[model samples]
Target: MGDTGESQIKSGQGYPVLKPVGDSAICIEFGDEINDRVNDLVYSAADALNARSPSWLRELVPTYRSLLVHYDALAADYDEVRSDLLGLAASDSAAETSSSGGARQVFELPTVYGGEFGPDLDAVASHAGLDSEDVVRIHSSIAYRVYMIGFAPGFPYLGGMDQSIATPRLATPRTRVPAGSVGIAESQTGVYPAASPGGWQLIGQTPVQLFDAQAQPPSVLQPGHFVKFVPVDESEFQRIQAEVANGQYRVAHSEFAS
Candidate 1:
């Protein structure tokens, strides 16, 4: 949103270190906070660099406060890759582009908020100092921003949570958090794209599969998209779940092109 020019500003040593995760991947870290400003800048540069990535580049992974850009050591040396990363870090121009703005998608996630579907719903309500219905309303009120997709395939790291509804993770992690398990942790809320072991505070679950390996994009949602959880009754949840089980769920796409 400001000047998009290269700056020699350096993240102090031990602050935002660029280290090699593996033989081919290098991570560029920003800081510790998961604020809007930090994630926005990171995703902006990532989108721009990804749009015109070099031939040696393999994959670009964006996290809350860092970016993992994997490249070939044979075709491109570390120095060359570092130099490219420096340019990306310095330039603010990419963040100013129209495409860099909030690329939000409004998703109507049909969820079953209580009962077995949401075991921690009552706990969350107690922790938030509100009734169960109030908790559900507050949780579903905001249009959450998809910070980054990681942890599991198509798992969107959502932000813009109502602090009133914010709660810590479960003391003991669950063995199996089914796909579509909507949960909140710290100041963020997200869905379990696939069945996985997790510790987030479960509040509800959606019927749609966030990911499908057979689909073109695989994920129904992506980073920079917006999500709005729409609470539905048990019957509707069963109906949608049945559709997904039978491969009849109508997956919606975001208006990202505009």
Candidate 2:
């Protein structure tokens, strides 16, 4: 989409900044920082737009602190759409949508830390000035929020990792990191959904299949969801792997107030 000459527009105080992202899309920025409150606004905007069900609406892509709205330029006037977006942004419903305490799905991922599966576990532990066992305990202690799914298919960019175990990425990225490999890079922790080159510190590996082409809504993880790592033994990992391969395993999940 080519950039339209439309200048940035603000709906007023507390509302998002709407900027034209080419001729067919608009970037609705909620805030300048990456945090839960800003993310909630992004989700709220998306929810409000979807509820309106405008014919011109094509897709709503929610990012860390903004919502990208794609529209059918031929069917709808840009000014009208912009006005509608501003109206929604300033409405009480939009604020209420975000403030409503709703349940968010939390997936429990069983992981096996260290050994062959996690080649960089020792390096990570050494960097953190702690033992491998302590590293594992600290890593799995809290539930992480899935900020956005990108970089690779079903790959979740997670947040809320304890800074104590934070480690930098590999000096030289591996040519190929195995799928289901859980890695820590700086303050973020995420799982490699498929076999691909990556640089995150490999501390653990989960047996869950993150992406399955044959299944409906292939990606097991979704944006705005939570992931809780459950450390498992080698035997348990093997059992879960076998079950996953046979299409019998179901990732343990529950709902918690967001």
lDDT of each: 0.79, 0.85
CA deviation > 4 Å runs, candidate 1: 1-23, 88-95, 252-258
Q: Estimate each model's TM-score.
A: 0.84, 0.91
Candidate 2 Cα deviation (angstroms), residue 235: 1.5
Residue 203 in model 2: lDDT: 92
lDDT of 1 by residue, 114-196 (tens): 78898999999999889999989987787777889987899898887888888999999999998889998877789998889
Q: Report lDDT (Cα) of residue 172, candidate 1.
A: 96
In model 1, the clashing pairs are 4-92, 4-93, 6-90, 105-226
Point out where model 2 deviates above 4 Å. Answer: 1-15, 92-100
Query: Could you give me the TM-score of model 2 versus the true structure?
Result: 0.91
